[model samples]
Target: MASQVDHRYIERLFRAYYSGEVAEKIFHSAPEPEKREWAFLRLDGPMVRHVKLTSIDDLHSQLDPPPKGIYYSLSTYEYPDYPMPDKQRIKTDVAFDLDADHIRGAVLQEVSRCKSCGWIGEGDVCRECGGEVRKIQLVDDRTIKSISGEVSRLLDRLANYLDVDIDRLRIFFSGLRGYHIHLEEEPYRSLDSVERIELKDFLTLDGVEIHHAKEPDSAIIRILEECRDVLSEVEDVSVRQVLESLVNSKDNPRHFTSIRKRLGEDRVLRERVSRTVRELCGVNIDPVVVTDMSRLIRAPYSLHGKSSLIKTPLDMEALEALDPPVIALASPSNNMVKVHVDYVPHLIWGGREIPSIHDEDVILPEPLAIYLVNMGLAQGLRHV
Candidate 1:
């Protein structure tokens, strides 16, 4: 719901950035650029799709006033500019999207804004004017850090377990929340949608089955061992004892019957164990992104319209010490801008905590101002 002025101002900023040398450098770094179909989310909200940009100049030409968001197909096609059904897909890079919102225990605040009276708070209706409201989820730093840990785990699994070459993998911050991993190597690129789903199942353990045989699956044993603390939270003392005994049994077939019996008797315990296995041993990734052969992903170094932050590429070392606020620092400007702060959830920026604000004028760095305005939490006034 950003005002027209705010949208135009943000678009101007993006246009300037996209025209600069820095953006050129980043854009050129993209792999196989001409093979993917490009798409843009325009400032006025329509999408321009199935476009092909063969060079940096072609890309910049499309920027004009600059689009809010940029994206490219994961699959390389023979005719990158053609419509989806008509285009012949050559191969698709395997990709994974890990979002902070999908992580358990993420702190979320419901921020609501009334459309009729411009009143903002937390609820379905406005307190001041009793008007219809729109709500959005705001996450804190803890959630981001948790997702970062998951990213690390995923990288480890990809490199060590799946034997993916380190050189072929690319990591990027999605700019809004979470990370995106792209595997551009052979075997992975040629995998069909079904094969991709099988890979997703391996990583997330989405449909893992527990057998009632003499020799327990090593994966189940690993899950039980790793989720010992989670199992301890089971309310039934007998169930907890059985799980603990099973974990100590070293994949012994003798304990399987007892554990199975206990699980069959208590539905809650069965559910708890299944949930724990997924939470502890599996990566919480967007399965659709992994399985979809024709997925479109955020273009690297492109600005995320909602946050005005760049979809930044990162090395393994850089990812280990990544700070969410630092990503915003990569935005085009840092100069102060005055804006009417209508309402904002509690936010952390530039290593400082900003308390929620409502109905006041404040001077903020240009990047922060653009972010707030783009998110419809503030209205632009003028440059300081």
Candidate 2:
């Protein structure tokens, strides 16, 4: 059963949200069925216009299994500024690659794309036009591996601490440099935008959780201020504003580049925005796992102090002295064994999570209370 919510909780949540108290921690709850309700939104929001969506061929590698992507649902709601009762609520179906692309494409419309630099621009000039875009690795079959190492063990530990059922936790290989966790649990399903934001605000930052902040709202400062210089394009503004702010302006303000509205301005502003986002951001993202739901790409400096991905200075047994990665041997030889990840879902093997079990379990050196999955951890798990 789900927890009973009251007007007060809702009020507090709305207040926090309106005040820009971002709730980036919704993916921490270990709730059973409600787990699915819990998910994460990526800080590196996709640059989309119309939709000729990419294929879902989600990738998983040995050294680095690609970083997970943040997940957000197009919810329906009624706002005070608007009379319409249905708007973007923050709750919707949890889907994967082609599935997500298909659904999101329905809501978005693809426009201009940077043919030279692979930049997804709105109504703007291609990267080659300005000849200013930086170079990136080609997306091919020998995909770029970024995770799938000791990171997975870290995820298991956090998940176990939060008590999220292992079964409902579904991990995905985000097309980018990360992984995505999908929580199919409750109270999560019941959350509206405010509540969802509150929850999101609570867990995972560029890599840390806000609720666990040593200094009040430290996570907020890191996410909204420090990382603002290179986040996503507004779901509303133009690329010119993006460029002006980058090349012309001094500070980068946090905003959304809506996927559906605003085109003319975006086209004119895209070039500059594209430059600042790539050059200055400089791999500015560090994937943070949320209750096995979303993966947020944040500044590593802002979260280096809070990440639970056990440091890589120690070994398995030594790591066990702390929180260890759950490991299970396929046979007595111990040559081929499985690492139990009943808790944490964002396990970073080589900085990314493993999308398949066929790979060997990668444990961190200095571990932290990392829990392991014991058989069918989901048999008794509930669904929200």
Candidate 3:
């Protein structure tokens, strides 16, 4: 059963939203879902449904009891009756979802509950029961740093590979892991599924061969730079020597071909180069987000109920300095509530680690308490 406080928190967010500017922006088109087409909302458990909105005022009225999340259909139909692709389909902005799974050395919070024994534990599995687990992981600061770097790479590709204007790009925190880069410009918004797939291929570097015939000079330079970066980290003198020789070759297609040939012959070296290229160029994008026009993304500036964090827009210029805890704070109240935690290895607050104990009462500010409660690390006592 859902707790009263949990339910009320969602209600408070909705009330705040109705009084804000973002809700007006989301329902700007005055979308109306008919028949097979509908707007999606995430309520509580066992509640995944759609509602039809006729006007902007209707949206305001409908969201009186705010939902945990809001996502409108990306696919737009001419008749507004069905989501059939053949019916003169309209626009879908180019979007990419980058997750923290690719981020290395980040401590991601995990709350797993066992299917067989109903045992809850930290990490990906139930320690006592060893059953199949459902996990809810929180993105940490390290993850934000890693994903920000990835978004920078993506921005580079958007400009260089796809010939997109950098100004068209809008970056937003997922209110959880990583960021969403939305291309809100002319040609990109009009790009069809096949064209978007082509864009996806370019961003993901899928089927890109590092051969003389197809490899570009810019790509060659990127490969050489990555090789240099990996070689510098390597302790083996022989491996470094081999990589140096290959990377220092003539800056041409033939040299790149030779480099590929040499790297391919040695399995260990090939794997190393592959990992480096993947790390440098590959983006962890949810392909369905880009491919499916009917897919719904969490609306920007909306609250992520699970984390109690706003899916806030970010300035790309200062991505490295982004602080997740600071970004998650939407509340002004400093009132602390004592929480009964199940288990959490460490708690990061105000950009620093704080004292915490498993299965013990720990007092935290309202925002942090909401975060911990949502993450399943602790339960906020109503009277605390």
Clash pairs, candidate 3, are: none
Best by TM-score: 1
Clashes of each: 0, 86, 0
Candidate 1 per-residue lDDT, tens place, 1-384, comes to 777777677777778878777557645655688888889899888999998888888888778868888888999999989999988999998889988778665555668988898778888899989989888776444445557878876776677567798767888878767788889889999998778888898788786644332445565565566657677666767556655776777756777776676666777666665555566668888999999888888888888887777787778777777554545544556667889987776776555576888788988767667767766678964768
Instruction: Score residue 121 of candidate 1 by CA lDDT.
Output: 80
Instruction: Give a tens-digit lDDT track for model 3, residues 215-312.
Output: 43456445445436556765656555545655665466566567667766777766554455454445657767888877666766666666656676
Model 2 per-residue lDDT tens digits across residues 1-384: 111232222223223322331122222212221212112221222321111111112111100211212222222122211322333233332211211221111222223435475443334465447534332211111121222322343345335434555456554433222333444455444444454443433332222222222332333333333336444544435543433333322232222223212322455344444443333222222212222222222211011111112112223332233222211110001221223322222233322243322123333211111111111111111111
* lDDT accuracy of residue 237 in candidate 1: 72
Q: Which sequence of candidate numbers ranks them by TM-score, best first?
A: 1, 3, 2
For each candidate, what TM-score against the reference? 0.87, 0.25, 0.77
The lDDT leader among the candidates is 1
Q: Model 1: how far is 303 from its true place, Å?
A: 0.4
- Give the lowest summed-lDDT range of ten residues in model 1: 208-217
Give all candidate RMSDs, comma-separated. Answer: 3.1, 21.4, 4.5
